[model samples]
Each structure stands twice: as C-alpha cells, then as structure tokens.
Target chain A: MDVRTRNNVVVTGREDGPALLLAHGFGCDQNLWRLVTPILAERFRVVLFDYVGSGRSDLTAWRPQRYSRLDGYAEDVLEICRALDLRDVVFVGHSVSAMVGVLATIAEPDRFAKLVLVTPSPRYVDDGDYRGGFSQADIDELLESLESNYLGWSAAMAPVIMGNPDRPELGRELQNAFCRTDPAIARVFARTTFLADNRADLPKVPVPTLAIECAQDVIAPPEVGRYVCDQIPGCRLVTLDATGHCPQLSAPEATAEAIAGFVES
Target chain B: MSGLEQDAEDLYENAPCGYVSTLPDGTIIRINGTLLTWLGYTRDDLVGRRRFADLLTVGGRIYHETHYAPLLAMQGSISGIALELRAADGAKLPVLVSSTVKDTKVIRTVVFDARDRRTYEQELLRARRQAERLAGTLQQTLLPPSLADVPGLRIASHYHPASTDQVGGDFYDLFPLADDRWAFFLGDVSGKGAAAAVVTSLTRYTMRASAVHNPDPVAVLRDLNAVLNREYAGADRRFATVLTGLLVPDGDGFAVTMATGGHPPALLISADGSAEYQHIPGGQLVGPLRDAHFASIDLRLRPGDTLLLYTDGLTEARTAHGRYNEQALREYVLTRELTTAPALVEELTRLLAGFGEGLDDDTALLALSVPPA
Candidate 1:
C-alpha cells in the first residue's frame, strides 16, 4: 500500500473505560503492540496509529526536515490527542516513542495523565557524568551501517533485537518486518532516533510516569531505564525479565499485566 | 591411448594462458596449453614433477602459501583474484586466476588476462582524484570569500566543510542592521551536497535582506521563514536550523537578543571564565509550514564576555571512543576561559583538528568577544 493510505487511526476495545494511546518506536509500527492490545482492549479504549513517516501512514505528511527531530513526532502525538479530545490519557510509547511522549507531555501537560515509557532512552550517547550505555562511536558506526547498506543494517540489527543467535527464526521475522518500511523514511527515522538528546525534558514531565525496561534488552538496558525514572519526578521503574528490546513482543502477557496494574494504581 | 587421441590431448594441454592441475597438496599432476608454451617447458618436462607454487613469482608464491592456499582449502574455491604468474622469461605477467579443489587427489585452475582491467582501474583512480580536486574547488566557491568584518567587536570565524567533493549546508555571516545595530547568524541547512548548498546560499541572503528592514532577531527569522516556506514548500521542501541575534553594544559588551529555529543553543563565555549556553525552548524548525514559531532568549554580554555560535556539527562530532558532546565542549570552554575572539577560534580549531574525520559534517563557528574597555 502507498504510505499516505497507511496513516490511519484505529480504535479498538471497549468505549467506556479510560483511553490509552499506543505509539510504536523506530522500526515497527502499531503491529509491535498487537499481542498486548487485546488484553488492554478488554478494560480500556486502545488507540493505535502509525506515525506520519511510518507504516500505512501518510507519506505526504512525512517532511524530512520536520521529522528529523524527535519533537516533530511528539507534535504528532499531541495533535492526535487533541483530535480525539483525549484527556487524562495514558500514553504508552516504545523505544524513541517514549522520548516523544516526554516531549509531547511537556508541550501540553494537561492532556496527558501519565506516561508509560517502554525501552525509552532520552540520550543514547554516554557522557562522563551520565551513562547513556552507548558511546558516540557506537552511534556513528550505526549511522555508517545504515548509510552503507540499509538491508545489511536490518540483517545485522535483527539478531541484536532477537537477543539470541540460537533463535534464528526470530531474527528472520524481525528483519522481514523491518524491511517492509520505506528506505528513505527508515533512514531519516534511524538518524532521528539515535541522534536526539531529550534528557533535559525528563525533569519537566509533571505527570505520573513509569519506565518499563527489558532486563536483557541490549538497546535499553535496566540501568538506563532506572536513570530515566530517577530523572523524572515521582516516576516508577519496572523491569521485565524479557530477553528482547520489545517486551510487548517477547512477553506480552507480562507487559500488559504490568501496564494495567500501573495505570489502575 | 591411440597416437591420434594423444595428439588431440596435446592441443588441449598447449592453449595462451598458463594452466596447471595439482593434487590437493598442490603438487602439479598436469600443466597445459599456453602455460607450458609460456613457461618454456614441454609435457614431458612438467607432468607429475612440478608444484603449482613453482610457477608463481616469489612474492606471489609466498602470499599464495600463507593466505591464498589456506583460504582456498577452507572455502573450497577462490576466484578472479589478482596474482602474478612467473613467465619462462623471468618476467611477471599480472593475471587473474580461479582455483578449486576438484577432488581430494587433484585441483583444477583457470587463468585469464587481467592487464586490461588493471589498466582501466588505474585510469579510474586518476579520474576520481581529478573529480575530488574539482569538487574541492566548487565547495570553496559556495562559502563567502571571507566573513564580513563588522566594526567594534574582535570577530574571528571559521568554516570547516566535511567533504571537499560535496558542499555542506553550514554557513555564518555578520552584517549591519539599522540604528547602529549589527545582525549575525550561524545555521545548518538540512541535507548536504549541491542541493543543500543552494539552500544555504538562499538562507544567508534572505537573512541579510530581512534584517535590513526588521532588525529584531525574531522578526528577521520570521521573514526568512516566510520566504523559505514560499520557495521550498510542498514536494520540494527545504528547512534550516538557525540562530539569529541582534548585537547592540551595551556598556563594554553587547546586549544580545537571540532567536533560534530548531538550532543548537548559543554559548556565552564571560571574561571571568564562566560559560553557559543560552537556552531557547520550543524553537520550531523553519520552512516546513507557512507560520513556524521561533523562540527568543535575551542575554546581556558584559565586558570580557565572548559569545560563541556554532552549527550542530561541532557538538555532534564523534570522538575516537565517544562523541565530542555539548558537555565536553562546555567543559573545554570553562577550563580555557577564552576572552578574545581569536583565542576562542584558536581553541575550537584545535579541538576540530583533534576530531579529524569523525566530524563528518560542515562546521561553522563564529565568536564575538568584547574586550574590557
């Protein structure tokens, strides 16, 4: 399908409960949240949509200059909330989407009630005072890899996402899914996701916040997750004993259970 | 075999390129056609007598046993690879060859003429060098012959292009506004190459023209934004991250009102060795939409305070082990306490040199420091 036709707002589940907005991160679209959505649908209104540059999203709206920064994606989240008139909404953002949620909440604090950040990182580049887990060289290599061979990057990155070489099928599946994205948008998103430094906005998040971390996640480790929670006020950190970056993919039942309890509490 | 069949086999053994068949240990069992012809040998001279290594140039033989042979044995086959063959005349013929173990007892090999490809590759290398030289000349033409020298402030600037062949989008300029006020800006246009260079030129000219009528930093940025949006909207969109400021001399230093359009924060280094980034929040990108909002920050530069403006290239430079981050730059400035424009530029240039190729983007640095009066 063309990218413009892909941009869609899908509302699923019961209409009576609190509304929940689900945002996927860099590589995957709303499909990443597939397993967890059904459980949330039983008790809450689950809203899922592809970001403008992503799957089934409007390619016409995907301006490279605008989407080059994470704040552009954050603006889309706020716009989506405003369109739905979603108040006291619980925003669950995965990977870089977590940082996007932070920026969106900072832009309009009244619209969001809580932010659930899944495998989120404000800054991936490590500083002497802060341990962002990856060095500048690591990110540079990633950018180089992306530029040299987009398909090769997906192939190389899939194993890291799978978290195990023994699970070759999982790596194959992840690579196949990542290959579905347009090369141009994927390149822009890759640059935007790895290059942003949103740590400054962490403390400005006034709403309740929860950072969900995957214990074995190479992308967003547990320590980084704790760092995020520590930066935001009155924020809680939870670690799932999942092996991959996408906990909602690896352990959906546990991930959904954690979110449901956190929101209810 | 009959005399007629043997004569037919002799023709196959004697074709122009050197050919050899050996056991898995590389002991020659058969040598063929032009290989025997070139090697000054006959069928009776080489059959089951010579090793394949005996036919290689000394260096080629050494490399073959050390790397090529072991690799080929492990991989089952190796091909079209460069190697030198030793001619009977003791001269080396640069050739490409393919070798594979046909069986545990024998190896099959084929040799082809590669003098043409090697010559072609050399010519290509020379042409690439010429193209790179021409690209360097074109890239320099994209930058101003020199940054406009504004009076009153000791101004020194530097523009470092990431690649000579492709022009980068980083640019900076200082010019006069009405009422004795001076307007200056440093910005990075999105993307690179000739297309980005065009946008960089457009932005610099638009900013200069807009400031003549509207000296306010915010207003000037708005005008530029309007022009850019009008020119580069829709499918052919282009945008820039810019920091524009109005410098009015106050006391000894200048009182500056800076507006940012999704650019990095400006660094204010005081004479007392204190340096801080002028943080402007919510500065949207310019030229994506018709009405893009830019944020402005006000800071009074005291005597001995030097304001350093730069593109993202500097902060995003990758180090050998890590990135040359904002914190590192801040700490570097704090330690030096640079009070003059020249001193700041010198230090920054040194830092850029240390970054080397890691700083793979155009970097523009403009520093304005007011001396104590």
Candidate 2:
C-alpha cells in the first residue's frame, strides 16, 4: 500500500510553504492536532497522519513483529517524509510521538530542520537513578486500564460498527475500529510506548529541539522535561503554563507559538 | 443562601454515592459526608490536608496518574473507572469512580461502592479463563502423546497451531496394527475449535478401525470417506483431506502403501540425497460427496531414505513475494538433503518457526524413515 494511504496522510495549506509535520501520542490520532494545526497551517504546509494501527490507517498492515518496537513507527515517519519529499521539515510531536520524532531525526537528520516535543519523555519507567515519573508497576496498571476500559470504547464505537449493512461479516472489522485500534494492537502499543527507554537516542538528535513541558503534567514531570532538554545538544526548554499532558488541546496558542518561534528562529 | 439551602446540604451529604471535588492535581477541595463515612475519615482529616489519590492504594495511585488523569485531561470526562480506595483502618474499599472537569481548575468526581460488582466481574473473568484452559486441555488430549516406536524405523512429528485461543483442525497419529504392521495418518478436518476437534477425533478413530478391518491403504481411506459422507450429509457439511499409510517389514527396511484423499502429495527423500514428491493424483476430498475417490501408491523405503507428510498450512503460508506453495516446499526439501526422519522434521520445524506471523493456519507434520545400518 502507498505510505500516504497506509498512514492516512492529510495535507493542508500552502504547497511551497516549509513543511510542519504533526505526530500524536498513544491513545490519540492526528485529530489531537485539530486545534493547533489550523494556526500552524496558516503560515506553514501542515502534514498530519495517524500511526498505522490508529485512526483510519489500515489495521491489516499491523504486524506484531513490525510494531513490536518503536523503530517500526520511526520507519513510518521516514517513509512519510520520503513519500512527500519533505526536506528541512519541522516536526511537532506530542507525548510518545515526541520520542518517535527523536527516532526519526536520528534516522534522517537532513530531513528535519527542527523538532518540537510537547509533554515529552525519553523514558516513562524509571531507571535506578533517573526518575521518569513512573515505575514498572505503574505501566502495568496502565495496561490493565487499557484492557478494562474497552466497554466504554466499544459503546462509543457502536456507530461505526452499525454503519455497515452486513453485521456478521463486518463485525470483527468494526470491533477493531471502535477505539481507533484493535484491542490486541492497543495492548502491544501500550506496552511499547510506556516501557520504552529512549534515553540513549537523545544525544543523536542532529537538529535543534524545543521541549514544551506542561507545568502540571504528571505523565512527563518537570524533571523529565529538564532531563530531555539537558540530553539534546542546544535543545531549548519552554515550560508552558498549560496544566495537562495534552497542552495542544488545553493550550493550543502556546503550543503553536512555541513551534512557530522555533521554526522561524 | 436561599431558604431551601438546608435541604440541599442534607441531600448532598446523604446522596446514594460519595461525592468529592478536587483540584486538577487531586488535592481535595471539598468532599461530602457520605464519602468521608465510607473511608472512615473525618472531613477535617481530608479537607486541605490530603489529595484524592492519597486515599487510593499504590496500584490505584499509579493508575490514577497514568490513565485516569491523562484520560480526564484528554477526553474531559471519564466514567465507571474501577479503583480500590484505602480506608482509615487499612481496609480496601472497591469503588467505581466517574469524574468530569468542572472547569480548568476543578475536577468533580462521584464514587460508588462496588464490592458486589467487583466480586461479580472477578467470577466472570475466572470462569472465562477456566473455560479456555479446559478447551486447550481437551485439544491436547485428542492428539497422540508419543509416536509409535517401530523397530528398524525412525519417526518424528510436530503440530503448529495458529492460535492458542481456539483448537485447530490439524491432526496426525501413528499406531501399531495387527501382525507386526503399523498404521499412520495425517489429515486436517474442516473448521476450527471444538467442532473441528470432534471431527478430527472421529476421523482418527475411523482410520484406526478401518486399518484393523483391512490394512489396504485404499480400503482404509474408502471406509473413512463412507463414514464421513454418511454422517455429515446435511447442512453444515464437514470434510477432510487425509493421507493414510501402512508400514510393514521389507528385508532390512520397510515397504509403504499410502493413499491420498484430496491431500497434498508426500515427499520422499532418498539415500542418495535426491528428494521428490509421490503425488497420488485423482483423489477427492472425503466426507462431502458419496463418490469421494481414494488413490494408492506403493513404495520401498531404503536405508537412509525418509518420507514426509504435512497439511496445507506448510504450503499455503503467506510470504513477502507470494504463497510458499508446493513448488517452494519441494525446493526447500531438495536443499535440506535430510538423511533421517528426525533430522528432516527438526529442520522443517525451524523453517516453519521462521515464518512467524505469516503462518496463519494450523500445520501438522509426520516423518518416517529407515536408519542406515
């Protein structure tokens, strides 16, 4: 399948404008950028896409071996860049996507001009001395949450399932799309995202980066934001007044301005 | 305050569920009397002194931060979240929490006592896990625990299941017949799970019975075909592809008589390292049609020569280029140049494992050969 179609790519704004790619975190899709994309699109060529297993992306292509590690998602980002022939791009990644952007930049630094990491953490599970704001026990609980919360997800996804004329044959297909991910895929992705330790990859980011830390994000605490900023060479740390893990949804203007300032400067 | 304010306070305090309002960081701003009573805490012990997360166990606290807080922040509301709240006397209180963002600063939560619901969900989960375990055990019991030990011959087999969640259709067995003769068959019944399991057991038993009644390879398959065709004649028709054989002493090695019923041809690897398929053509699937055809072939197994039988799962596996069909299997066999039955089966098992997620169907394999003296 075409990479664009596989990732459910959407492009808007000026064709010749410098490209600004937006990548969302786990439990979300490209739609997380709905508020921030409009403002960024006014001045830059905005590109948005879901990960292969999330949103409208093809679920059939979700191979357990491929998505077993974060590198598969990093490969997808590189593919998107090559498919669009985007160069010197500004990548704005939120939550787990922040690490994905880190991986992509490490893979092809020439393709990215700068990076904006919002509420980002290089690692979630804490190491011996480094506090990533969560422990191994915490991630396990989160996985349990993912498993048990499917009831609400299935109920919300009922419309998509009912929209099909044939119920029996398409039942499995609808179950996969209800939470924008198949339950099996979600479990793997959750494990991959939360248990990831990308601290070693921090130094390899060849492009300048902006670490947009929310003031009150429990997921990625301030210490983590500082550690990420300290690890990347010439990485700027911007503490947004926003109080949630999703600064884009809760504080879009600040998120947009941070990206704009970094790109223009 | 209005004159109706006294009743409003009474209702808030004595509501069916506990109500607690907290800051975005879970600092308790105000909590009703019902919740304080449930947790065995006074209003003074909570108000301005503790956070909502402080009342939860360590696991619950972690869940609150990692999932509950993030979801509430992202989705604006999260309802019916199961959690355990720690009480003043070190007791655990199971509760269902529903929280909504009142504004940017405040989070309003309603908590319901869920002891009975927790017990019920545990019972259901336990029952489901038990059923799956039982299904797995039942499927294992149907297959032979060990292949028959025949003198002057080597044997090996393996079964690959696509899913542990359900029983697969593939089956194989080797058992001694009367008068120093051994009977063996490898087949795949239609469908999966308990139903396929039933048909596979039936097919295995019928093959054994037919071999005892008359050990002719052709006659054995004919008997199986008649039994299946008669039993599954109506709607929900069942069918199978089988390769049945009898092994008897031929000097130092064994003479083999094999029959096929809509199954793939068996592979023969010679002592000289040449491998080829012994295709028994014109064989029709057993069970669906009354006139199902069975064809037989006779072959001599020289010392260091091996015979291999497998289901379609090995041949029909998907690959990056295309299907790994019969031609690919033939090429694979030729390159291996296996000398013994165990060696051939072991090598094939490794190759199949390399297929990883691509091998989406159940596969069964059996190999029989004579040892070089």
Candidate 3:
C-alpha cells in the first residue's frame, strides 16, 4: 500500500493488535478523541486524525466548494484507510462524522470491517411523514441568529450545542474553542454539517454497524437514534446515559466501555 | 426630624402614586399614606405586616422577584420597567417602576402612573399587527394558486417566507405553455419585503405571459428581464436570479430545456442514484443591463430520473461553518439514488429544514420526476 502523509492523520498504537480508526465531529479537532485514545491504546492500533480544514491539518488543502459536502469528508476517510493499509478496521465516528463514516463505507465497503456511529442523524428536519425533531422555521430562526450576530450567536448556541445552557462556563469554553476556527471555513462547514440529509444512504451501508445513542442528548435524541438503527441493516443500537453531544467529554468511561464491548463482540 | 412641624409632613403623605421601602429580602419596612389609600389600607395594615411583593399582581410579583429584583440587586438600580399593582377594588393599575438599593440594604421602589405610554404602545402593536396581516395576504396572492399538473411527472413544491410580517422576493411557478409544453421558473429578486413582493408579482406574471408568446425558456427570461429593467432599473436598481425551464414529454421521460439568469444549477438525480448539477455558464443577473446575457442548458430526463429546481436559498444556506453550496447538494443527491421527483424534492426539503436557522434567505423549491413506464 502506498502511504500518503496528509495533514491530521496520525497512526500510533501497538502494531500487533486490532486496527481502530477514530474520527471527531464538527467544531472540534482530533483532540476531542484524546480522552478515549489511551484507554483503547492498550489493545488496538488506534489511528487518529483531524478532518480537513480542522485542527493542525493542512489549511491549504481546504477547498470551499469541495469540503462543502460530506462526501469529500468520506473521501478523506477512504484515503486514510488506504494510507494506513489496515484491514478489518473498526471505524468510530462522532456526531456528523458518523454520517461521514456511513458515506465512506458505502463508497468502499471492502475497506472497513465495522462502524461505530456515535450520535448519528440521517435527517434533522421534521416532515409530515418523518420527524427529525426540528421544523424548517426553527432552522430559519437559528440561521438568522447566526447571521445577525456570529460571535454572540456562537456563545449562546454553544451551551445548546453542548447540551447545557445553564452551565455558562461550558458555553463560554465552547464559544472560545469554536471562535478559534477560521470564520469562512467554519461557516461553510456549518452549512455542510447541518444541511445535508443522508437518510437515503443508510440502507446502502453493507458493513456491520453500531449506532451509539446518547440517552440524554438533545442534539441526537433517542427517537432519531432508533430510527437510524432501524434503517441500517443488521445494526445494533446501544443507548448510553450520556448527557451532551460529546459523550467523550461528558462520560468518557462509559463511551470507551461501549466501544470496547462493540469491538470485542 | 421635625418637618416644618407636622403640617408640612401632611402634604407629602397625600401625594399621588405609590411608595414602598423594603429590606434586601423584600420584607416591608415602610409604606406611605398615598400608597395605603390606593390599596384601601391604613398604615397599620401594611407597614411591617406584608412584603412589598404582596401588593403586586401575580405576574407582577413573579416578574419582580425573577427579573426586576435580581437585576436591581446586581446593578444597584433598575428603572422604567412596566408593572401592575393590585388596587383596592381588585383591579390592576398599570405603572412604571424605578427601584434603587441603598447602603442600608433597603430597596426603595418608586411607582408612577404609565397609562398614557401604555395606551400608546397598545396602539402601536395593533397597527403593526394590521400591517403584518396585510403583507401576509399580499404575499399569498403573489404565489400561484397551485402548480400546474404535468402528465408523466410527480411534482411537489414548497416556499418558505423569511419574515411573517413582510413578504420576500423569492418566487416560483409551474405553468403550462401553449402546445404541450410546461414552463416553470424559480427566482429571487434583490432586497425583501413589499418592494420585492412587487417585483416578484411582476416577474411571475411576465414569465407566464412571455412563455405564452414565445414557448422558449430563454426568450421568456429575456422578455421578463427587459420589463424588469425598464420598471426597476433607475432609482431602485433591482435585479433577480431566475431559472426558467420548459418540460416536454419524451419517451418514458421528459426533455428539460432550462435557461439561467445567474441562478444556481438544477440538480438531476438519475434512477441508479447518480446525480449531477446542470452547468449553465455565463448566466448574468436579470434586469441589471439593457441586454443581459442568459445561458440555456439541455438535459434528457430518463425514466426514474428526478430534476430539482430551486432558488439560491438552498445553496447559500449556512451550515456549521460554511454555506450549503453546490458541492454538498451534489454529494447528497449522488448518495440518495432518488427514483422519483417527489423523493428528490422531499430530500431537498429535508436538507433545507436541517440547515435550519442557518438558511437566512427565503427559499423556494420545485421538483419534477419522470415516472418509470
């Protein structure tokens, strides 16, 4: 296998163990997976990387139009799999990255063995026939708030995004971290993460899948998580008593345990 | 503290409005004669007998404790907030309140009659509601009663207004042209509200009329552009991005001939789950020039293929950190394997709804799918 040293893709672990690839979601870089890495490091060849346009990745590789779609993200995933030349790999993706894993697996089913999707949502809109917990009007209000005051909206939306507005400091921390992102890239990424609906692609995923549902998560509620599992063939749904969007941040031990169980099984 | 003897003190006791003083915890420490009279209570009935919150209406009390009191404590003073007092007759008296925290940990709350300002605000709200209703009704009329039904196709369209009280410039129409052709256009006029509504109405009417006379998509846009340029070119300098397409039924499918005036490309999702955006280059803004150039693109819609027409609202929608551009649309459409038009439009609408709050402009979506024979 020809290995390409693209930015943000870090491969480190005992080469003798099973291969596991860890991916983070939007508004965060690879550091988010840090808490869970050491726990898994003992048994698996843990591969970690930032998605393009995030963290210490090659900023010059960022293309506004190309990165605007999640498929480009899936492309990077496949590239990482090719570069690492790993077989029977367990792919773990958080938040929107979970959907990215689905797309990537669909693109190259032979490259991956199993997928562990954390808080995955195929659709976020409510229709007459379907419910994703939000209405078009609600999205409009959120967009307007974002445009009217980007910084203030980020600060206010942080707690909501973090799933606890009462913890003002958490909201502040999220805002500060989110503000570190390039405004233009962040805006495009925001659109891509929220706007694209991959409900139709769920059925096409051929690999064994595990949908890790967060019990108290407002971002990916129980109903939506169950719906996602129902759509994917031969997929198991496990609900963890995690509160926020980032379970690795709120309940790292439970999250790690779940992954460990899934991988062992 | 003899106040020019007791005679002069009597004048202050009889003054209008209410006054009360309380400790930091809201325990009543003092009450004046005027406030006592208004509540039909004597000095003994109020002073040290009840908290200042007791005289307020239920909502007023809640507001005072939750917002007013806390704000006052944090800021040392709060003023000019409206509140309601429970009067002697069990009626509510509207009043403006100002509160200050003193060094003694006592809070002095001064109340003033706000009947005039209250009345003015009520009238203002009523007028605003009336204006909003008018705009809503007018905007409703600007849209087609229903999109014209075409044979061999399943269609569904949705229009999201930006503001309830004001109409936006985005508009879409699906109508039949003479001789078995259907012309549909989705466009966004510059600016928003009433002025944009006028342009939207005119564009919709003009497109229909122009299509009746010339059955070609490019010709219809050209003629509409001339009219809009003539009408709105001078002081307003209004323009719009429009995509007009003519659908003609072919063998088990329809041939879509579309012309673009700086509009986003239409998405075509084939039966096998492959999707691509119809590239129409050199499409300039309509109504900006006397002779604005427009580009037309042609595509053969096969059985189980879906064509989606939309305004820039979809592409420009904000995501987590970026705009929902053509690339995302391509990725989404490519993965879905949409077999019908309703499926295509349904997914598009779902995508738009997901972008929620990030989609600032008014969005209009129209989808046409050729059924499998």
In model 1 chain A, the worst 10-residue window by lDDT is A149-158
Native contacts, share recovered per candidate: 0.00, 0.07, 0.00
Off by over 4 Å in 1: A1-265, B1-114, B177-180, B319-323, B371-373
How do the residues B1-373 of candidate 3 rate in per-residue lDDT, one tens digit apiece? 7755577456667657667898755667877787777678778877777777677764455345433553454447655566667886787766777788889878898777777866775687578789889988998898887889898889888887766688888888898877888888898999998888888888889998999998788898889889999998678899989999888988788888999998888888887777888889998989989899988988988888778888878888888769888888889787777777777777777677656467888888888888875
Stretches off by above 4 angstroms in model 2 are A136-179, B1-6, B22-29, B40-77, B86-92, B100-107, B141-196, B208-218, B226-373
Predicted candidate 2 versus true structure: per-residue lDDT over B1-373, tens digit per residue: 6776669889899898999998865679899999999999999999888888889865566456544665566567766667889999989898878888976669899999989977786687678778778877977877899989999999999998887668889999999998999999999999998888889999988998889999998898889989998888889799999999999999989999999999999999899888889999888898988877788989999998999999999999988878889889888888877888889898888778767577999999999989986
Selected candidate, larger TM-score, 1 vs 2 = 2
Q: What is the Å distance of residue A166 in model 2 from its true position?
A: 19
Clashing pairs in 1: A6-A56, A6-A57, A7-A56, A7-A57, B13-B33, B14-B33, B15-B33, B15-B34
Each prediction's Cα lDDT score? 0.77, 0.83, 0.77
Instruction: Report the lDDT of model 2 for residue A201.
Output: 93
**Ranked candidates, highest DockQ first:** 2, 3, 1
Show model 3 residue runs off by greater than 4 Å: A1-265, B1-19, B22-27, B32-40, B59-81, B96-112, B232-236, B302-304, B317-324, B328-360, B370-373
| TM-score leaderboard ranking | 2, 3, 1
